[model samples]
Target chain A: MNEKIRHLREQMKRLNLEGMIVSNPISIRYLTNIQAEGTLLITRKENIFITYAMYMEDVNSTLTINDEVIVVDIKNISKDEFENFFLFCENVGFEEGYVTYAEYKKIYQRYKVNNLVETEGIVEKQRIIKDNIEIENIKKACEITDNCFSHLLTFIKKDMTEKQVANEIERYFKENEADGLAFETVVAFGENSSKPHWIPSDRKINSGEPILIDMGCKYNGYCSDMTRTIFLGCILEEYKPYYDAVLKNEILSLDQIKDGVVVKKATEIIDENLKRNNINLIHALGHGVGMEIHEAPIIHTNVESYFKENMVIAIEPAVYFPSNYGIRIEDTVVVTKNGCIPLTKSDKNYIVI
Target chain B: MNEKIRHLREQMKRLNLEGMIVSNPISIRYLTNIQAEGTLLITRKENIFITYAMYMEDVNSTLTINDEVIVVDIKNISKDEFENFFLFCENVGFEEGYVTYAEYKKIYQRYKVNNLVETEGIVEKQRIIKDNIEIENIKKACEITDNCFSHLLTFIKKDMTEKQVANEIERYFKENEADGLAFETVVAFGENSSKPHWIPSDRKINSGEPILIDMGCKYNGYCSDMTRTIFLGCILEEYKPYYDAVLKNEILSLDQIKDGVVVKKATEIIDENLKRNNINLIHALGHGVGMEIHEAPIIHTNVESYFKENMVIAIEPAVYFPSNYGIRIEDTVVVTKNGCIPLTKSDKNYIVI
Candidate 1:
C-alpha cells in the first residue's frame, strides 16, 4: 500500500469513515503517481482507481501489478457494481473544499452511505509537510527557475514589451527541461507593477523604471514560485528607499520564520517593519508551495497557523506605492527546526540591467 | 446596467432570488470584463465586486463609473459591512455547479438569507448563445488556429519529437498575436494518436506514420479548437480506411448540425454511419466553445439538448483503434438558422507532409 494512502486511511479511521472519495485531480496525482484522469476510492477493503477506457492503457503502463491500488474502468463497470463498492460503508468522507454541491449529491446517491462527512482538508494538511522526494523535486524546479531568471537578466533589454519578456521566460523554461510554467508569468513594468497580479501587456520596458518579473516553473509535478523587482537601467531616487525597506523587511521576515513559529506573528513582524518605513505589505507574506502554486498555511495577519518542518513555502514581501511603482522580493524556502533555508538561490541584491 | 448582469437579474427574479453570488472567474469575466481575482455579488439594487487592495487598481482600470458593477476593496470593508450587503434579501442564489460545499456554507453563514437556492447553471445557460462580439472574437481565434495549422504543415518533419512540434505550434500562436493557447496542445506521433488526450512526449516522428495535432488558441478571451491528422510520407494501408471514414463522418456530422436540431440526433447520425464501417465514436461528437474551450450543449448520444442560433461549437469525429492509431477531424463552427458556418477554414483533405 502507498504510504500516503495508508496515512490517509489512518486519518479516516480517526474520523470513523469507512470509505473516502478523492476526486480532486491534484490530490489524486499526489496519492497515486498516476497523472491521468481518474477518481480514487478507498473502501473498507481495497483502493480502487476508476477511470474511463481511454485512460486505462496509460494507467496500466504507469502502474505495475504489484501496486496495491486496483484500476477499474468506469466503462466496464456497471452502475450496480459502482454503487456496491461502498454498499456497507456507514460513514464516507469527501473533499468538501473541492467537490461542488452537485457532485456531492451525485456521490451521496451513488454510494448510498449512511453518513457522508466532510474531510475538512485532511489530504491538504497531509500534503503540507514535504517528503524527501517532494523536496528534491521542488529543489530541482527552483534551480531551473533560478537559472531561467538569470538568463532573463541578460535577455531582457530596453523597449521590449512585457509580453515578449514573459514569452521568452516561458520559452526558456521549456528549453531548460521544465515540465511547464507553474502559472502565467507576470511581467509588469513601471506603474504596471503596482498591481500585484497584473497580467503582462504590450507595454514597452523603459530605463530608470522598476520592472517586476514574478515567474515559476514545474518539474516532476512539483512547483516553484519566486518574484523579483528589477530596475531596467538605474533605480529612481524616490523608489530607492522603498526597495531597500522591502528587501530589509523581506530578510527580517525570513529570519523570524522557523519551525513552531506562529505564521501570523512572522507576517506581522514584516508588516510592522514596512509600516515604520511608510510602506504597507498588502499581500500575504508567504504561502506553502508544492504540487499547487498556492497551498496550505497562508502567512498573513489573520491566519493563526504554525510553521512546520520540511514545508516548502514561497516568501514574497512587496510594497506598492500605488500607480507609481512596486517592489517585491521573493524566494522559495524549506522550513528547518531553527530556521528556513532558501531553495531559490538567485541573487537578491539590487540589479541595474 | 450591463446587459449580461441585467439578463442574470431577470433569471434571478424567476428563481425568487434577491441576490446572487458569482464566484466562478470565467463567469465574472463574462459579466464584468474584469479579469482579476474577485467575487461578483448581484444584490437586489446594485452590483458589487469584492476584491483585495492589490487588484483594485487593475479592476478600476478595467471598469468605469458608467459600469454598473461597483468595485469594493475587501480590505477596506468590515465583516459587518460585507454581511449587510445581502442582509435584506429574502432568498439568495448560488452556482451549485461551480461553488464548493465549503464556499456554500460560507455564503449561507454570511448572507443570512431565508433560502439559499441552487441556480442550476443559470449564468452558464445564458452564456451558451454567443453574441456578436463573442462570435467575432471566436472567429479571430479560429483564424489564428487555422494559420498555425497551415504553418505546421511546412514546419513538421520526420525525426522531430512530439514536444518540438507542440512547442512550434505554441510559438506560432504567440508570434501571431494570440493571447495564449486555449488548452495544452496535443501532438501525437503514430500509435500515440490513439489516445484522445495524449500529452505531447519526446517520441520522435518517423516516415510514413500519421501525426495527429489537436491545438487551439485564445484571442480576446474567446477560444477556438481544431484538430488535424497528417501523414509524414504516406498513410499506412491499415490506417487509410479508418482515416477516410473519420473524415467522411466528420463532414457528415458537420452538415447535420444546425440551429434548432437536437444535439443527440446529430451525434447519433454520425455514430450510426461509423458503426456501419466497424468504427466506434468513443467520445462526444462535439462541444460548445466560447470563453471556455469546452462549454455547454455537449453533442453526444446521451445529451438531450438542441443547437441554438449564434452558438459556437467544435464538431469533432474521431476513430481510434486501441494501441494502433487514430484519426480525428475537428473544427469550430457557429450555428446558423439553416446550417452551421465553419470558423476554422484549414484544409481537412488528406495531407502528406
Candidate 2:
C-alpha cells in the first residue's frame, strides 16, 4: 500500500474504525493520487474508488497496480453491491467536516454500516505536515510566485487597471511551468487595498498610491500564497508608519514560527505589537498551505496548537484603514526545528515603481 | 425589503419557519446583494448579516438602506448575543445541502433554537427562475463569451499550446467587460478532446486534429458556458459521423426545451437519440445557469421536473470515444412559452481553422 493510505489506515485503526468512506475529492487525491470525482472506500480488506463512467478512463490512467486501489464505476454497481462493500465492518468513519448532514444520512442508509462515526478530519490533520514531495512542489510554486512578482514590478505602470494586472499575473503563471493560479489573484489599487479579501476591479492605478497584490500559483497540485503591498511612483509620508509596523509584525511572526512553538502565543505577540501601533490584526496570522491554499493549523488567538516541523504555512500581517489604504507583507515558509525558512523570498522592503 | 428576501419570507411563512440561518455565500448574495463571508439570519422581524471584522467594510458597502440588512461584526457579538439572534423562534431552517454535519451541530448548539430544520434549498429553488436583472446579466455574459470564441478562431494557429490558447481566452474575457472565467477554461487539442473535463496542458496543436474548447465567462454575477469542437486544420473522415450525430441531438434537445416541458423527457429523448447512433450520453444534458455556472433544474434522466419560463439553462450534447476524440455542442438558452431561445448563438457548423 502507499504511504498516505497506510498512514490513514493506521489512524483508522487507532480510532477503532474498520472501514471509512472518503468523499472529499481533495482527500481522495491526497490518498490515491486519483483526481476524479469519486468516493473512496477503505474497507476491511479492500481499498476501492467508486467514480462515474466518464472519469473511469482518467482514473485508470492515473492508477497503477502497485497503488492497490480498485476503481469501481458507479453505473456498473447495483444497490446490493454498494451496500455489501461495507457490510461486515463494525464501525465506519466519515469526514464529519466535509460530509453534509443530508449526505451523512444518505451514506448511512446506502452503505448499511453498523456505526457511522465522525473521523474529525483525520485526513486533513495528516495533510498538515508536508511530505517531501509536497514540500518540493510548494517550493517550486513559491519560486514561480516570486518570479511573477518580480515580473509584475517591471510590468505594472500608471493607468493600468487592477483587472489588467491580475490577468497578467495569471498569464505569467500559466506560461511558466506552473499549473495556473492557487486562487483568484487579488490586485487592489489605492483605496481598494483597504479590503483584505478584495477582488481585482477595473480601477485604474494612479501615481503615489498603494498597490496591494496577493497572489499564488499551483505547481504539481501544491499551492503557494504571498502578498506584497508596494507603492506606485513613491510612498506617501503618512503611510510609512503603518507600512513599517505591518512589515515588522510580519517578520516577527515568521521569527516566532518554529516547531514546538505554540501557534496561539506567536499570534498573540503579533496582535499585541499591532495593538501598540493602534492597529488590529483582523484575520488569522497564518494558515497551513498544501494542496489547498488554506488548510489546518490556523494561527490565531483561539487555536492552541504547536507548530510542527515540515509544516508549510503563510505568515501575513496587515493593518487596514477603512475606506483608505492597507499595508500587508506576507511570505510562505517552512517550519524547522529552531526557526522557519521563507520559501517566497521576495524583498519586503518598501518598494516603489 | 428586497423582492428576493420578500419572496423568501413568503416561502418561510408557508413552511412555518419563523427564522432561518443562511450560511451559503451564494444564497446570501442572491437574497441580499451583500457579497461577503457571513451568516445572514432571517428572523421574525429583521434581516441581519453577521460577518467578521475584515469583511465588515465590503459587506456594508455592498448593502444599502433599502436592502434592510443590518450588518453585525462577529467579534462584537458574544455567545449570548449569538444565541439570542434566533430567540423566540419556533423553527429555524438551515440549508441542509450547504451546511456540513459538524457545522450543523455547531449551529444547533450555538443558536439555542427550538428546532433547526432543513430549508431544502429554498434560496436555490427560488434562484431557478431568472429575474429581469439576472437575465440581462446572463445575456451580457453570453455575448462576451461569443466574442471570445470569435477571437479564438482568428487567433488559434498550428503549433500553439493548449495552455497558451486557454490563457488567451482568459485574457480576452478580462480585457473585455467580463468578470474572469465562469470556470477554468478547457482547451483540449487532438486526442486530449476524448476526456470531457480535460485541463489544458502544454500539448501543441497539430494539423488535421480535433480541438475542443469548453469555456465560459462571468459578467456582473451571472455566468455563461459554451463548448465547441472544431478541427485544427481539417476534419478526419472517421470523426464526421460522431460530430454530426452530436450536433443533430444538440439541436433536437434545444428544440424540445420549452416552458412546461418535462426536463426528464427532454433528456431521455436525447439519450435515446445518442443510443441510436451507438453512442451513450455520459453526462447530464445540461444544467441551469445564472449566478453560478451549474445551478438547479439539472437536465438529466433522473430529474423529474418541468422547465419553467425565464429559466436559463445550458443544453450540452456530447459523445466521447475512449482513447479517441469526442464531440460536444452546447449552448446557454432561455426557456420561453413556445420554445427556447439561445443566448449563446455561436455557430454549430463544423469549422476548419
Candidate 3:
C-alpha cells in the first residue's frame, strides 16, 4: 500500500471506521496522486477508484499497483457491486466538511452502511505537515510568484488600468509555466485598496497612489500565496503611520512563528501593536496552504491551534482606512524548530514604482 | 424588490417557505448584482446580506437601496441578529445542492428555525431562462472565445507542449478583458484527446495527430463554453468516421434546438446516430451555460426537461476511442422560438494547422 493511504487506514482504525469514502480532490491527490474527476473508496480490503469511462485511460496510465489502488469505470460497475464492497463494514467515514447533504444521503443509500461517521477533518490534519516533495513544489510556486511581482514592478505604468496589471500578472504565471492562479489576482488602486478582498477594476492608475496586489500560482499541484502593496510614484505623508504599523507587525509576527507557538499569539501581537496606533487587524493573520490554496490550521484570534515544523502557511497583516487606503504585507513561510523560513523572497521594503 | 427575488418569493409561497437562506455565491449574484464574499438571506419583509468587515466597503459601494437589500458586517452583528431576520417565519428553505451537511447543521442552529426545507433547485430552475442583460453578457463572452479560437489556429505549432497552448488560451481571455476562465482550459495533444476532461500535460504536439481544445471564459459574470478538435498535420483516415459522427450529431442537435423540445430527445438522437457506427455519446449532450458554465436543464439521457425560450446552453457531442483518438464539437447557443442562434461562432470544420 502507498504510505499515505496506509497512514490514513491507521487513522480510520483509530476512529473505529472500517472503511472511508474520500471525496475531496486534494485528499484524493494526496493519497493516490491521481488528479482527475473521481471518488476514492478505501474498503477494508483495498482502495478502489470509481471514475467515468472517459478518464479510465488517463487514470490507468498515471497510477499503478505500487499505488495500491484499483481503477474502475463507473459504467462497468453495478450499484450492487459498489454496495458489496462495504457490506461487511459496520462504520464508514466521510468527509463531512466537503460533502453536500444530498451527496451524504446518496452515499448512505449506495453503500448501505450501518453508520456513517465524520472523519473530523482527519485528512486535513494530516495535510498540515508537508513532505519533502510538497515543500519543493510550494517553494518553486513561490519563486515564480516572486518573479511575477518583480516583472510587475517594471510593467506597471501610470496610465494603465488596475485590471490590466492584474491581467499581466496572470499572463506572467502561465507564460512562465506555473499552473494557473492559486486564486483571483487582487489588483486594487488608490482608495480601492481599502477592501482587503478587492477585485481589479478598470480604474486607471495615477502617480502618488497606492497599488495593492495579492497573487499566487500553483506548481505541481502545490500552491503559493503572497501579497505586496506598493505606491505608484510617491507615498502620502499622512499615511506614514498606517504603513509603518502594518510593516512592523508583519515582520514581528513572522519572527515569532515557530514550532509549539500558538497561532493566535501572532494575531494577538498584530492586534495589540496595531491597537496602540488606533488601528485594527480585522482579518485572519494567516492560513495553511498546500494542494488547496487555503487549507487547515487557520491563523486567527478565534482559532486555537499551534504551529508545527514543516507546516507551510502565509501570514498577512493589514490596516484598512475605509474609502481611503490600506497597507498589507504578506509572505508564505515554512515553519521550523526555532522560527519560520520565508518561501516568498519578494522584498517587503516600501517601494514607489 | 428586484424581479428575480419577487419571482423567487412566489416560488417560496408555493414551497410553504416564508424565509430562505442562500449561501451559494452564484445564486447571490443572480439576485443581487454585488459579487463579493457574502451570504444572502431572504426574509418575509427584507433581504439581508451578511459579509465580513473586509468586504463591507465593497458591498456598500456596489448595492443600492433600490435593490432592497440591507448589507451588514458579520462582526458588528451577533448570531441573534441573524436569527432575528427570520424570527416570524414558519419554515425556511435552503439550497440542498450547494450547502454541505456541516454547513446545514450550522445554519440550522444559527437561525433557530422551526422547519428547514429543501428548495428543490428552485433558484436553478429560475436561472435557466436568461434575462436580457444575462444574454448580452453571455454573447460577449462567446465572442471573445471565438476570437481566441481563431488566434489558436495560427499560434499552435507542432513543437508546443499541451500546457503551453492551454496557458496561451487563458492568457488570451484575460488580455481580451474577459473575467477569467469559465473552467480550467482543456488542451490535449495526440492520444491525450481520448480523455474527455484531460488536463493539459507536458506532451508535445506531434504532426499528423489530433488536438482537442475545450475552453471557456466569463464576461460580466456570464459564461461561454466551446470545444473544437483539429489535426496538427493531417487527419488519420481511420479516425474520420469518429470525427464525422461527432460533427454530424452536433449540427443535427443544434438544428433541433427550439422552445418546448424535450432535452432527452436530443441526447437520444446523438446516442442512436452514434450507435449505428459503434460509437457512444459517452457524456451529456450539453448543459445550460450562464453565470455558471454548467447549470440547470442538463442535456442528458436521464434528464426530463424541456427547452425554454432564451435559455443559453452548450451542446457538446463527443466520441472517444480508448488509447487512440477522439473528436468533439461544441457550441454555446441561445434557444429561440423557431430554432437556436449560435453564440459561439467558432468554425466546427476540421482544420489542419
Best by lDDT: 2
lDDT scores in order: 0.89, 0.92, 0.89
Q: Candidate 1 vs candidate 2: which has greater TM-score?
A: 1
Q: For residues B45-143, what per-residue lDDT tens digits would candidate 2 score against the true structure?
A: 999998988678778888888888899998898999989988899999999999999999999988999999898889999999999999999999999
List candidate 3 stretches off by more than 4 Å: A64-66, A233-244, B54-57, B60-66, B75-81, B157-161, B202-211, B231-245, B350-353
Name the fnat for model 3: 0.87
For candidate 1, lDDT tens digit of each residue in B53-86? 7678779999866668899998888878877888
Q: Give every collision pair in model 1.
A: none
- Between candidates 1 and 3, name the one with more favorable DockQ: 1
User: For candidate 1 chain B, which ten residues in a row score worst on lDDT?
Assistant: B107-116
Chain A TM-scores, all candidates?
0.97, 0.97, 0.97
The CA lDDT at B136 in model 1 is 96
TM-score of chain B of 2: 0.96
lDDT of 3 by residue, B197-290 (tens): 8889889998999999999999999999999999988988987877887788888887888899888886787789878878777788899999
Taking the true A–B contacts (Cα pairs closer than 8 Å), what share appears in each candidate?
0.83, 0.93, 0.87
How do the candidates rank by DockQ, highest first? 2, 1, 3
lDDT of 2 by residue, A1-353 (tens): 89899999999999999999999989999998998788999999989999988778879999888789999989898999989988888999999899998898899889988999999899999999999999999999999999999999999999999988998898899889898899989999999998888888879999999999999999989999999999999999999999999998888877888899888888888899999999888888889999999999888999888999999999999989878999888999999997789999999999999
Best DockQ among the predictions, by candidate number: 2
Runs in model 2 lying further than 4 Å from the true structure: A64-66, A237-242, A274-279, B64-66, B76-81, B84-88, B237-242, B274-279
